[model samples]
Target: MEGCKRLEQLPKSIGSLSCLTNLNLSHCDRLANLQIHILEQPSPLESGLQRRKIIVHLPGEINKLSSLVNLSIDGRIHIQLLNLIGDAEHISCIPKQQTPDELLLSRCYVLKSLNIKRTRYNKDGSSFSCISFSDFHSLTELKLINLNILTIPDDIGQLQSLEKLDLSGNDFKSLPTSMTNLSRLKYARLSNCIKLVALPELTQLQTLKLSGCSNLRSLLNLSHAFHERVRYGLLELGLDNCRNFKSLSYQVRQLTSLIHLDLSRHDFEEIPESIRELSSLGTLCLNNCKKIKSVKDLPESLKHLYAHGCDSLENVSLSSNHSIEKLDLSHCFGMKQDEHLITQILNDGFSQVVCFLNNYSLVN
Candidate 1:
């Protein structure tokens, strides 16, 4: 009964419909109780409780829906009690927990995608044991963000059908080596995982984002995973604000197909000379890289270069026949002081370039 704004509850007798395959209770703002109805469900193939503002509890009786195939409970409402069951293909829930209990996920045998976001931290430091993910054979995408997860089981690699994984804002120090076995995994985002110290070789990934992982010290495994034959598959890599990661130069030379690279907030004094090897690189971000004094040895394929807020930048060398379409050196104090540097930049065969210098811009 969707759009039933005043519907307060489902009758307990309604559960007797053994063949009930679909139940949609969307936009039911006053409906608050489903404990009795859910506990008696003999068989339900689909159930949706969307936009129910007063429904905050999903009692353990939901596990009784043995034949349920698809379940979706969406809205801005926060769930106070969560119970997972059935052979559902897709599941999404936001639960307030001290420690996210992965053991509850063991029952989703045929699940395809799961996203669980923890809304609070555990003050008592109590948590359930991690369960093996090997049973989720049909699972393709999994996102468990900000759950204070220290690690995951090795059986995670057994998810042969998995493609995308996002564990951003978690507390993982490292990942299991078995993750490399996911041949079809294309995207992985670990942004803001401040405690993450390392990662396994996931060469099959086309996009890897690690924007705020400050403790990470090396990326040798990621680089070593690629060779001349397969390196061209990786298209995007983000390492912005990864302060201690210094193994960028040599490893980047291998990603011949990289189109976008973010090196913002790094302490490097110069752009890696090996960057010129990225023949497919189009966008390069060096914003707030204050230590870099000169810009040179750029890739000929670079279309956009962002070095804004680079206060120490003084000299910039661009080839006469280069393919650069835009260059941003805004807020570079050193460049504004050197009149010769400014004059040299204007005469560097940039007749068709759009350049941003200090507070002004030049579009020739």
Candidate 2:
């Protein structure tokens, strides 16, 4: 649909094509109305026009496309296919140019995964704030990045089959209590949400990444999530660059199934020996923890250890039979270890870990 500058409307009978499956009105500069009720599942209908946008004003027909399962459209097209779409399992709609007020998903009841992300990410660009999220109980994964949403509807707790959720780069301040209902949810990424301040309780969560948030002061009720997920099995947590995080209210000793943890660039001083309860712990990074003074009760399952810039670090506990691979103690001026213990670690594990760390051992 290129160079059709005078095209204003399509024949109204176009919606009567009960067997019509494909529609490509992309790049149509002057096209304004599309009276189509696609019967069969249409293929990816791309409307990515680099020069001019193809305008398609949808009519108020709720029963129009009752059979559309997949409809991929790009470019700035103002159309509402929500109420007209019922039982769709997958849906993607991208209007790369304009920021519409609402993205209605109240009609896709059986949808398993829904993504409404920006065609491109811009730090200062505008994003949709108002959205209709309802009746999508069967959703398993939901990614709505760059939608300057300030709050998630409490009804989101209705997604019982949800496994993953990515709401990065949004404007939410507090998560809904409804998310406490996602029993099967395992992964959540909330990076770059600058206004986010809190999270809800999760039962079976395994991985939670809060990397770029700036105002988050704490992980509210983390003990509940830790207790529930640890009972369910292994998990991972990352708290990188969350500059305002000031406390961990949860009991750390009970997290036996935690496999990976990142507490880099924080102001904490001591790591409790209860950390030894992590039988599955493999990677531990304490880089730049300037005030840390001792390290003991290291877990046997540990495979990598990095404490490169801990200026006051003095003691490091090691077992001859541990599975440790690499230990970075660079710039740790206060650490003192027996030469014999180093020989034992080298004998049981690969030479790379021992020799690499040995170069930084002090001359005491």
Candidate 3:
């Protein structure tokens, strides 16, 4: 394959080299018109390379590599490539097709990771039927973005090996019950899905982000195992702009490993007493919670607390020996200045505590 600076088509005889294990044809800018069927077939040489993987930078013509274990493509590819590869474990496609539900769900039994991003499609079109996930058995990571999807397949939980899933900027109204079966899942991000109303039970999940989901209301407790794992493995949880959630005190306490928790823009009237039970909590943000009236029962491990823009907050009582070092109560309308509490904090010699006062005076 010399002097092939601009190979327009792959040699069909190349498949005869069945021993070929690794083939790298990257950055051949002049290479074009690669036929899918030729690349899909296994080479005949029966050498070690025959069992190896294939990496191609050409268009969607890679369905010919039936022996390929790993297939990496640069741009849009033919959907038939899914049916040709018998044991393809990894597939990376540059977002090109309108909807890949059928191609993805068809041979998902062997596929492990699928990354599709920046795909464009009609918002209210028939393309929804093309996105299915009935056979995703070995899938571990699924990332779909800018697809304009309205809902996810109810059988998504069938991917028992799934660990990380990102479905941002979609139109899902609620997660399906089958999602509870994803016991191996650890990280899930559903940010900017404004229509979502509730979250599915994640028994083994550790990190979850639901930012910008305005319609979300209820987040029921998961199974006992789920709660137990979260207590140890869960580190961060974000629920920004979820106005419908009124309380998360009990749930927050269960995550003993949580170091950072954000519950901004909610409607809670006060920080729940249960929050004080979070011994590992270090940063707690309740900013823009206009309905909250007080901040009490401070946690001993807390180092930073943000309650800014809480218009209804009037009284904030800190525990005498609390470990809090930074307190931001700025713009709290109903807060009353208490000189005694301020003096007590200053005398404690907790020089790190940056308290925001109503009169802008130092506690000393």
Global lDDT of each model?
Answer: 0.67, 0.61, 0.63
- Candidate 3 at residue 233, lDDT? 62
Q: TM-score: which is higher, 1 or 2?
A: 1
Task: Write down the lDDT that model 2 would get.
Answer: 0.61
Name the candidate, 1 or 2, with the larger lDDT value.
Answer: 1
Clashes of each: 1, 0, 23
User: Best-fitting candidate, measured by lDDT?
Assistant: 1
- Whichever of 2 and 3 has more TM-score, that candidate is 2
lDDT comparison, 2 vs 3, better candidate: 3
Q: What TM-scores do the predictions have? A: 0.68, 0.63, 0.62
Quote the positional error of residue 304 for candidate 3 in Å: 1.5
Error of 1 at 25 (Å): 13
**Once superposed on the true structure, which residue ranges of model 2 sit more than 4 Å away at CA?**
1-110, 119-127, 220-234, 246-250, 287-294, 307-316, 328-344, 351-364
For candidate 1, the lDDT comes to 0.67
Q: What would the per-residue lDDT of candidate 2 be over residues 1-364, giving only the tens digit for each residue?
A: 3334455555655544444433444434344444343323233437642322233433232222333234343433333344222212122632212112222333334455666565443556554543445655667788877656666777778778889999887888989888877888899989888888877655467888777787887664655554454344337877766668644525445456789877666566676556777889998887777878877678889889888778888767777667777778877776655566566665665655642242545221
Error of 2 at 123 (Å): 6.3
Candidate ranking (lDDT, best to worst): 1, 3, 2
